[model samples]
Target: MSLKILITGAAGFIGSNLCEYFVSMGHDVLGLDNLSTGSLSNIEGLRLKDNFNFLKGDIRDIETCRKAVLNRDYVLHQAALGSVPRSINDPITSNDVNVGGFLNMLVACKDAGVKKMVYAASSSTYGDSKALPKVEERIGKPLSPYAITKYVNELYADVFYKTYGLNTIGLRYFNVFGRRQDPNGAYAAVIPLFTKQLMNKQSPTINGDGTYSRDFTYIDNVIQANEKAMLTVHPEAVNSIFNIAYGERTDLKMLVDLLKMSLSKYDKSILNIEVIYGPVREGDVPHSLASIDKAKRILNYQPQFNLRDGLDEAVDWYWSHL
Candidate 1:
């Protein structure tokens, strides 16, 4: 049976990808985005599709959120104000959009009788724990305002499920990067930012002595987790948080070198560019690596793209488009 779905942040990098995939699968997809961080050009192609609908609105507005959820079978809640530094500088707006807006979506999803809400949680929730291969059941105190908000999201999801019988699956995303990820922002993700810098023959700066590592998951893996979370009938999967990652770690120095290698295929001059090291920014974890055993056992998630392969593909896209 064809399902009706609502994807928040549908104009964003991950959200637009989700919209395209689901719509192509013959599902009716309604996309809601305020276009703050998301660009309309990301989904302008889908706007012409018959089964795809777009709503220019904000999730902070309960009325708009309620309207978007009407008749939708599932809600992919990806709308949020991301970035640790931004959250640190302006915690109030981040809370308003991430926490308050998240509540509105939960209420709308609950009121509309939506089946499941698969949301984008963050690996930042792992916080300050020194544990290698961070697990779902074990977590430490939040290290930043952004981390606190994401942790709160998981808590809220649990409460909603227990109290009102709402079904939700939280995918704690690690350093996700792929096509459509914006490289032009004060808070741009590492991969895209570095890719753009190399493209421009500019040196990409490394924060700290370049030892900080992250799981650095590809976007496709994240989409797979969302699909599994939405359609899985497994009784144990609902109302749980799963780490969505490639189950590997690459440090900043290695990441830049690998990125340089990929970009060199297009412009060999990029290989000669230097890397500048700077002081570490606040609210950043020293290292992050996910233990994907829980997601593998429950969601049956097998990430196809490791960092090198995913970076090659992403570099190809950037070369052709950028």
Candidate 2:
């Protein structure tokens, strides 16, 4: 069955993928973006599609959010300023966009009487805690401005559900990377940034001693989690947050070696590229692993790709495009 869907940040890496996936399913999908961190080219093919429409707008504006979210069946909210370093550099702007804009979207959704809003939450919400496999119910102090905004999102979502009966599901996304993820930004993700550097015969830099590990999730896995969160009929699935990841962890040193191996298929010289180590950036946790048992038991989410499988595909895409 086809449904009306609103995907904010529809021109971004994750948002664009959601837009394309839902559109392919023959749903009436409306995409909203400000083009700040997103690119129109990401959804360029869908530009002429019959059922997909793109609205150039920001969620910071209540009117814009209300206008875009009106009459939507479900909203996949992925728009946000995403990066600890970027947030640290400009905390004010990050707060305005992440917190204020998130509030605007919630209000608009409530007013419009949307069905359910599945938003992009962050794993950084589990800050300062030394837990190995991060559980949903337990969280630590937010280590960065970006983490605080995401945690605040969860709080607002909970209040909206209890106060106004607004149904929501938050997915605390770990390191999500895949095709169409920009590799040139000042805040580009580790995988893409490293892939780009290797493709150009340049070395990739490691922020720490290459010991910092992460639950590197693939974009497709995230999409699967979103769909389940959006469509699940299970009563317990709504008004909850789930950690969306592969349920595995990989250190930076292993991550770089895998990247080199994946890219080596295209260019053998990539295997020779050395990794550079530097001082750890602020607000970075030494290790991050997710307890996907909650997601799997609740949403029945089964991630299809692991780090190795996804990295190969991502390398292939970057090799051809970049």
Candidate 3:
């Protein structure tokens, strides 16, 4: 059955993809984006669709949040100031948008009586933990302002669920990358940034000896997690946070090698480009991997694309678009 959905950050890499997926499934989609970090080009294809409605608004405003949640069956909240480095640069702005804006959305969701709200939680919430595959129950102290904000999101969601009876699900996303992800900005994710540099015959830089690893999840896998979280009828699924990842970790060196190999299919010169090594980033975790057991048991999430599989597609998109 088709549902009425409101997707915050609708012009962003992940949110725009969510908008497209829901619209393609015949759902009525109301997209709200401030376009701060998001680009309209990401959702340009959906602007002409009859079932898709675009609203230029900020989630920080209570009125905007309330308006967006009205009469909506489900709310997929993805708007936030992402990037640990950016948060470190301006912790105040990150707190304002991520924490303050999140509160506004929760209050709006509660008052509007939205059936369910599935938000983009972050794996960075597992800050400083030495565990190999992170589970939901165990977490370490937040290492950065961005991590604090994301962890706060989980706390607020839990409170709203218990105090106000709001149905909320938090999907702690791990290194999500794919088409439409910005490759030009200082805060651009590693995959797209590396792909762009390699495609331009420029060398890509790796921080910290290229040994740092991440559970690089594909965009499609994340979309599936959102969809399942929104539609799940199991009582255990609602009002709970689950890790959305591929259950595998790939180091930076391997990641760059894979990108070069994938892009080499389009341009052979990409294979010869050397990677530069630099200082490790501040507040950056050495390795991140997620235990998807909770998500699988509850949401029945099965990630279809592994790192190499998704990298193949992502590299192709950058080759054509860049």
Query: Which parts of model 3 are misplaced by more than 4 Å?
Result: none
lDDT of 2 by residue, 1-322 (tens): 9899999999999999999999999999999999999999999999899999999999999999999998999999999999999999999999999999999999999999999999999999999999889999999999999999999999999999999999999999999999999999799989998888988898888998999999999999999999999999889988999999999999999999999889888788889888889899999988999999999998999999999999988988988898
Summed backbone clashes in each candidate are 0, 0, 0
For each candidate, what is the lDDT? 0.94, 0.95, 0.95
Indicate the worst ten consecutive residues by lDDT in candidate 1: 313-322
Query: RMSD of each candidate?
Result: 0.7, 0.6, 0.6
In order of appearance, the predictions have TM-scores of 0.99, 0.99, 0.99
Once model 2 is optimally superposed onto the true structure by TM-score, how far is the C-alpha of residue 223 displaced, in angstroms? 0.6
What is the total number of backbone clashes in candidate 2?
0
Segments in model 2 whose C-alpha atoms lie over 4 Å from true places: none
* Candidate 1 lDDT by residue in tens digits, 1-322: 7999999999999999999999999999999999999999999899999999999999999999999999999999999999999999999999999999999999999998999999999999989998999999999999899999999999999999999999999999999999899999899999999999999999999999999999999888888989988999888999999999999999999999999999988888899999999999999999999999999999999999999999998999888888
